[model samples]
Target: MRSLRLAAATVACLSAVALLSACDPEGTDTGDSAASGAPSAVPSTPAAAKSPAAKSPAAKTSATPAATSPATPGKAGRLPAGVWVDPKAVPLNAALHWRAPGPAKVLGEQGKLQIETLCHTRRDEYHAEVAMVETASLGGASGDWKADETIASYGSGADSSGVIQTTYALMGVFAQGVKDCAATAPGAKVTVVAEDVDHLFADVTLPQADGSTVVVHEFLVSNRGSIAELTLRADLPAGARPKTAWTAPADRQALSDALGKPACTAFKDCV
Candidate 1:
């Protein structure tokens, strides 16, 4: 059970799509105060596969001009071939509404794919509104990439037994930076409320130099080689903070389940 918590916390920390930083495996600090917003001495970029280094296979084809594009009578606004996940895959909530998927960004060299969608919710008579970015990634090589090695890049350190500890320390730096805009910036505070190897849950409060505070809840999950990240952000509210726990979507299971359908069934190699 403890391992599960660590996995979940790690996933939440790693799933922040907008704040992608490279991790180093060797330079991890193993101390009780490691989670106290300490700056990691490790390099920012990890040695694992860099998304920008890999080229997408789909980019080789030329797209037709919009003026001469063929219109399908029944299908409008559909994603071009090769993209995975749709709005239906988003989790439902009474207070939240799902937005359409954003433009797909292809990492040609890594053959990885990324797309984002937003879930919007309003706060107390429109004083503030929260927008959660739901980001998902599909790995290349038919999802053969090493999940552990990829995760290790985000500060797993050299001690295999302390994977959870190192992950929390590394993630603490990231959460602090996200709320305060800098890891070492003044008034930045991050609390690792819960974590595991595959998932993470964090409560971050960034007190700006301007006297305002930004609070956020971050959740992440990784199954097989695919990843899903959700970040909930809003103004610091009085009283208790809102919950931001998340579970993997059913359709996303295809990436891991060998007997299940793959994300890109149309591709022969995906099978």
Candidate 2:
């Protein structure tokens, strides 16, 4: 679970958030994965990832978002190389240059990560009729890296709702898990900055395998029948962070505003 495992594998996401615990010294991946036994047909979510208002900051992080600066929305009507939203196509700052999204893959509801396993709160038992996930990431090419993890999921109404609820619910618990884990692990810190019922934002700092540390900005959003996890990770940037100014595309938000938007008939519909 070391390094949050983002460097090791690219999605299918913040499970729109999945992450490994920092327990393993060798960085063996564990927990927060949506790929076990479940239908690996769609992309999942990651927010650095995985919290609530009580467990999160207010509506914004310490970093102030630029008022006049609007983020660029995803490409309209552009189907992704994968099934759903293109990671590279999300709302982003127009000033910064970014690398294209990596390949998309399948990831779904995962088991407990090593840190969660050590958590005092007992896990819940909730099941869904269909759970399909596909994941991908967008990032900078070098120095001052900005990496975004996009996890999108779709399925039956109940399952999609369940996924969103569980994701929001777990964010708080995961926040605590990070602190407890940080007690023993150096250079690992997680903070839930801002949140609402449908979305969450967190700032995370994790030590890398190469003895480096990276800062990540994250968001977790829940649509009626879908979930989106977005993140921006960088070493040191020159300007304001992006998530502070993030806004989903109008088309996507319009669909999410409804009962079930971004409807997918099958798993591949995401990938």
Candidate 3:
């Protein structure tokens, strides 16, 4: 497939007080490496509904932030045949510790959303996996933040070579989504902070009406045929923006790396 759009949340999580979020996108289905945002378009999930980086509808979550779980290596999980992630089994490593987890809602049989890349016009192309889940906490103060994580699994039947090809094709989708975002959002500064072959991190700052700004950082990583996304959405008040406001968080890289840990043994052989 070809040509992708990073549309807003289809069943995406919405929250102004969320620091982190997990979204499945819904957009163009022309597969093979697309955009990267926060919704569940089969091709992408990096931004929001209205603007390229607008406020998406967050998945249901707990009111308070969950405590950080202890990091444990080798805690890497196993991939059971045709089985997705187990909310109860996902261990909390120093790298991935979203203490508070919301209910996991799967979307894909209906249609997967796209994760737009490039920040220019909010148009991105990121091909997603089979099952997609968007999640996040809702309702909170402006200064506070919430978080969520979305993962796309290609399933036990995916070929490693195909998964590798898809990952390679999507190398620059997130960076492109940043450019697309800047094209539309006024005074909005969206930039790719860090990236590698299988992962990307970007920061988006949008000026608000009351002299405030919402800074969102999205981190995505791919393994085999799976993509795990960790996003941070924060509302910074005027005169309170820190110098590090536009930079990737200290643990973003680590968090992203730990996402596809202990590769599910199921992917070792993709004949």
What shift in Å separates residue 17 of candidate 1 from its native position after superposition? 68
**Candidate closer to the true structure by lDDT (higher is better), 1 or 3:** 3
The lDDT per prediction is 0.32, 0.42, 0.44
**Residue 56 shift from truth in candidate 3, angstroms:** 24
TM-score, each model? 0.32, 0.43, 0.49
In terms of TM-score, the best-performing candidate is: 3
lDDT of 2 by residue, 13-90 (tens): 443343443223355543444335443235665442343322222111212131111111363212234333433345
**Residue 208 of model 2: what lDDT?**
59
lDDT of 1 by residue, 184-208 (tens): 4445556665445444445556665
Q: Evaluated with lDDT, which candidate comes out highest?
A: 3
Candidate 1 segments whose C-alpha is farther than 4 A from its true place: 1-92, 105-185, 235-271
Q: How far does residue 26 in candidate 2 sit from its true spot (Å)? A: 61
Better candidate by TM-score, 1 or 3: 3
lDDT of candidate model 3 versus the reference: 0.44
Candidate 3 stretches with Cα past 4 Å from truth are: 1-100, 107-133, 136-142, 157-160, 209-211, 237-253, 262-271
